[model samples]
Target chain A: MTEAHSQRPGVEIEFRSVTKTYPGQDTPAIDNLSLTVPAGDICCLVGPSGGGKTTAMKLVNRLIDFNEGEILIGGSGVRDVDITALRRDIGYVIQQVGLFPHMTIEANIGVVPRLLGWSADRIKARAVELLDLVRLDQNFAKRYPSQLSGGQQQRVGLARALAVDPPVMLMDEPFGALDPITRNEIQDEFLKLQNEIAKTVIFVTHDIDEAIKMGDRIAVLRQGGVLAQYGTADELLGSPADEYVADFVGADRGLKRLSLRLMRDLVKVSGENHAAPADAPTVKGSATLRTGLSVLFASGSRVLKVTHDDDSATVIGTVTLDQLQDAVYETAPKAPTDVVVAGEA
Target chain B: MSFPTQVIPNFSGPNCAGQFFCWDWVGANWFSVLQPALIQHIWISALAVLFGLVISIAAALYAVRNSWFEKGFSALATFLYTVPALAFFLLMVPITGLNVGTVLIGLTGYTLLLLFANTVTGLRAAPPETIAAADGMGLTRNQVLFKVQLPLALPSIMAGIRIAVVTVISLETVAAQVVQAGLGTPLFNAQRNVFTTGLITTGLLAIALALVADALVVQLQKLVTPWVQARR
Candidate 1:
């Protein structure tokens, strides 16, 4: 992870005392909101509707201009560049996916690149590359958006956003509409994709669980667009600043936190190489601690075998319930506090 | 009297000289008169639709951006549409001097209400999410309007054009009242002379021309919006 972080390139987005008010509204939708997402970090802005979370994301790309203060991308004001050029350089995904129904998947993915004036050949090449990056088949590119399933359309939407290889991404509930199984599938794929791309992402979602799962840093916003708390997901769930955030994180935060740790991180290597127990339940090293715990309980076992395939499926280690609990507590603080702040300044 | 008789040859009932229809008269006039009228009818209708489309699209785009403009333009187009076609043609004759100009101006006005209303509806019908996505991706105002909004609105716009073309084709026949061109001139002459074959041939040909124009527009719409047809 550290090695990947060292190589990742991304832009920093800073919102300094930003405020946006709709016409004829008495109160500002976003009132003096301030936050910062460091380069190569996924900062999830989680809040209820009308909490200004979506509005805050929009302000980043200047989709909706702010009434006061400024938004800076990579230390430069968003307004400094031409609007189209600025947009071309920032990837954007929405809940609806908004894939142009008229265009084929290839054309949809190539939109930003074409807007940037790339040649036809270059755009086609980039479209194929993006389809692969988003884990979609190249053949799918020629299909129209209407022909794609909901999950496929979302993937294409993500591919289109990444077409220009923009360093920053503004995602407004990109997976909010999918069914739970597909949503989880795409979210996992998105996380894997982020590892390769390392974009500075400002993701907005009303789902706190999703935010906790995907965000490197989570910003909890209240009704008036107030930044109630901003910190690592562990910190936000472990210690919410107020009742509003506490309720938002919900009662099952402990289980949610288990999702943050991997079984590999909690596995205890056995000193003696023993023959594999045929009856012992096996969990992949890549499985979440939560899944390992579930398998342990379901199989009525004190310990579960951790298997990872290098050449063949071999028992690499064992993870006991005790070790899983200890590992969870031990690694709780280890969640990167790269920029953990409590309340707004 | 002989000139009228030569053009019509027979004014009587269904079967004249034991023939069901005046095939001879139609064949004779096909090159000399009816053929020219068919060409002129097509020319006038095509010009009216072309000019009307340009004007309406421009107005609709503008109206989509401004609510006041939408309301004002719509009301004006409706007013122009409500004006009797014959009266409007007659009104333009004084200024246009019984030329193609008088007929085209009136026909264009008749098309404006349908085209303008549909264009506005189409432009406004672009999904909000789609518009936001386009804008968020850094498309300029013009690019969004043209590349995103316009293309998405094309299905509705094409429907409007189809209706407008058929309407203009039928209306161009009215142009024959003032100018001696189009299928209407022969049909009117047949009515005056009570020539059964000339009336049937001209009336049937006018319907056929409108249907042909309509079919061509439908094909053009399908060609441009393959995505729409492909969905089905």
Candidate 2:
């Protein structure tokens, strides 16, 4: 399975008993953190401040080297790789959008490739390709970062990171600086991009909602850089590892679990019962059961007419609150079969 | 060459129509007296600023991103500025006695604080995240400093150079007391002879030199930082 995954564009990232301690500080920033993110998944490292989530992500790119243990990307240890060559292959995006004020957007997007000595014509072509990939206008390539809106600058940031088409990405609160509306828009756009590119990613954030929305495997870090829980969003909301994990996930874990299941996924698992045509409060098939429940609760209706994502008015099926409740437990029962390498230490 | 007195022998006060700023006297003495002084002024200011800039760049690079070094170096540069210009020249006179060296040394000392502080500030003008991104994106240490930080720092560095150039031009006038160089020579000679037109003419020439240097630096700044102008 590991060999098969290595051949893919995205490769597995494993943190094996990784511990980091800063000089002049006795306490470890990240104490024996161990988890594995399968190919093409986002492993969100989330906790309160001082949790070492950022430190753990940095260890992957060797930005901040670890005092003990090892980090392996695609089965090879990170320490053996040449540092500059290693970094050039890792896409990095930060909250500042990483767009330096001096460079034009085209130059910014072409940075990594330029560092790799791509031909001038190739870099220019790559810049246009990336601007379009991140949904920016081609004319924006000539503008400086200061002329761009906060959201536009981050799009440029994303484009720059993807310039070399690296297999791994490290994003530290990349959208944390944007307003809520823009954050949601960029998050959705990024998810759509990730679907096509499939880069293994280590995303650091303090926000749990962002973690649950973004992570395929969520690693809930506790104080002192301890891993309290490592599992899918559904597993995290369904059965937290401890009281701290439960509290970290919040009181509305059940509703949060529902948010992870779309009506289309529900129809696939639960059969044609969801295919019945009925005059009910309509919800899109692509939306979460959470949205269906919102409609179910709003109009005092028990069932919702689920429409195709493209044709929203057509009713494919009607689902009740009870049906969604069953889905909360039924979805993705693959279970947490991961190594859980450090035992939450 | 005809002496100023011979050239303007019929003048009432070695002046132009009794005006303090006598244009006739200026025209008569320009090549023989004022023009040489103006050339000397440009040379002194240029050398002082050039030396100051090289030292400031070295100092700024040393002081960058370290608060302790920044504070200590800024304090030293500021102290250099606080030394009265006369005292500064007097101190230099003991080591490199009354000549262009004393004037150059004194004027260069006067520019250190402005140039050093602004260069240090310019080198840090690239935000922490931008620098971090540069590093994270596989830029070597030197590449980050040269390609990223230096380019971002151009406006601040140019501003420092502009002020330093103008300050050195102004200081070169006072330098005449210790060194027989720059516009200060003619102005001092005019003072000794009580020639009103010569005094005012020399003074205005120094001011014009400072203005032209400042404008030239500004244009140079605009040329180097086209990305900065895109914001406007």
Question: lDDT of each model, Cα atoms only?
Answer: 0.81, 0.82
Candidate 1 segments whose C-alpha is farther than 4 A from its true place:
A1-8, A21-27, A267-284, A299-332, A335-345, B1-20
**Candidate with best DockQ:** 1
Worst 10 residues of 2 chain A by lDDT: A336-345
Write down the lDDT that model 2 would get. 0.82
Candidate 2 Cα errors over 4 Å, as ranges: A1-8, A24-27, A272-279, A309-315, A329-345, B1-21, B65-80, B87-99
RMSD of each predicted structure: 5.0, 5.1
Per-residue alpha-carbon lDDT of model 2 for A81-137, expressed as tens digits?
Answer: 999999999999999876878889999888888878899999998888888888999
Per-prediction DockQ, in order? 0.65, 0.61
Q: What's the CA error at residue A81 for candidate 2, in Å?
A: 1.6
Cα deviation at B30, candidate 1, in Å, is: 1.3
Model 2 per-residue lDDT tens digits across residues B1-232: 4535545332233435546566767667777677887888888889899899888888888777667987887898899899888678877888998789889878888888999888877887788889899888889988898888878888998998998998888877777877789888877887887777777778888888989999999999999998878873
Q: Candidate 1 — which pairs collide? A: none
- Could you give the DockQ of candidate 1? 0.65
Model 2: residue B14 alpha-carbon error in angstroms:
7.5
Error of 1 at B183 (Å): 1.0
